[model samples]
Target: MDKHELAAFLRNRRDRLQPEDVGLTSGPRRRTAGLRREEVAVLAHISTEYYVRLEQGRAPRPSAEVLAGIVGALRLTDAEADHVHLLAGTPLNHTGWHRRDVRPSVLALLERLPQTAGFVMSAAFEVLAWNDLAVALMEDFAARDPEARNLARRAFLTDSPEEGPLYGISDVTEFRQNVVRELRSAVARYPSDPAMTNLIDDLRDGSAEFARLWERNDVQPARMLTKTFRHPIVREITLNCDELHIDDGDQHLVLYSAAKGSPAAESLAFLDALGTESLNSRRR
Candidate 1:
């Protein structure tokens, strides 16, 4: 178990709750920003001393029942509760690294997707494979060095003013938050992966925004059903986003498509016909 992280997570959650939030009276002269440690302990049915130690990172791994009590006491969201379980429970075996390879069948599937911009993203947010239309809609991933293909890096580390915000997608802030949340879970799952650890460290050290969001201790991502891309070729095109989890490899097949006969659909078809070469030339 990650004792320190669990402690920090609990403390952060505890600090966000008000006394009345838990149906407790805000006694006069209350000085604390949120509920006190003692208040949390009382609500969790644990000793004040124990809860204090848990927050201080000195307590042993909490029992499942104790964790459940704390979860209730903190009023953590479903995602936050899962994060608590992950941090408090015995760590998963870190024997293998997160997979980066796309299954051949999945690669072929990307090619077969008609009128869709399709790509496979690894757990680390690397664009592992892409269809022709994906290249036209997004950047030409094949031309980028493998490290540059990482969406997380593109989300935060892109220093070029010309690059705009990650494919000029309309939801940069939300995307960055989701990236941080997903990476937090990824790092925990792959504690031994230098690549994973290093990637997160780089992001945290390089981007103040990333560091701030990381401290929020969020684990869940808000669902984004559609996305808008401000493409040089087609201008603004909105597409329905469908994410298919390749659980076997811990990858995702992301497809961006529009409803048939929609303006966005016409734009996608035009981009597909133009292809990557034409798109690249236009950018140049």
Candidate 2:
């Protein structure tokens, strides 16, 4: 079990709750931000000393029944509770390195999409496979080393001194926040995978913003419906964003498309014709 991570998760959850949230009176003398640990132990029907030990990262792995009680006491969301379970090493058949290979069918589908920029992303945000349009619309992932294709690294760590945003996308803040949340989940699901662990360590050490967000312990990222990319050739191209989950591999097929006969559609078609060449020239 990841004692440190489990302890931190529990503390973070506890700090977000008010006493009244669990039907307790906010006594005038109470100075705690959220419900007190003693209060949580009482609600969970566990001894305060034991709960304190858990928070101190000194306790043994909690039983499933005890974890259920703590989950209720902390008022954790479904996602957060699942995360707690993962950190506590509760077996959910979720351990392993995240899948990187794109399915053959998914690869074929990328080639079949007309005027759509489609790509497959692994759980850790590596662009595993892409159509020509995706390369044009985004960057040419084929040219970069496999390690450099990680969107998390691109989002957080910039080689440029000026530190420009990725792809000049309009929602940099939202995108970075989502990246942190997804990586948090990824690390929990594959705690022992060096790829995931090293990536998390690198980002936390390299980027202060990433470190701050990581401490928040946020699991649910807001869903984005549309994305606007500021391409040098097209100026501005907005597309409807659709993320299809490939459950078997825990991968995502992301498609960027524009409405039929619209200006964005025309721009996409133009990019499709220009292909990866235009983007390469711009990079040069």
lDDT of candidate 2 over 151-209, digit per residue (tens): 89999997694435788789999999999998888888877556788999999999999
Residue 158 shift from truth in candidate 2, angstroms: 1.0
Q: Count the backbone clashes (under 3 Å) in each candidate.
A: 0, 0
Report how far off residue 51 is in candidate 2 (Å): 42
| Model 2 lDDT, full chain set | 0.85
Q: Rate residue 18 of model 1 by lDDT.
A: 85
Misplaced by over 4 Å in model 1 are: 1-95
Rate residue 36 of model 2 by lDDT: 90
Q: What would the per-residue lDDT of candidate 1 be over residues 227-276, giving only the tens digit for each residue?
A: 99999889999999989899766789999999999999999999988878
Q: Candidate 2: TM-score?
A: 0.66
Which clashing pairs does model 1 show? none
Model 1 earns a TM-score of 0.67
Residue range with the least summed lDDT across 10 consecutive positions in model 1: 90-99
**Candidate No. with top TM-score:** 1
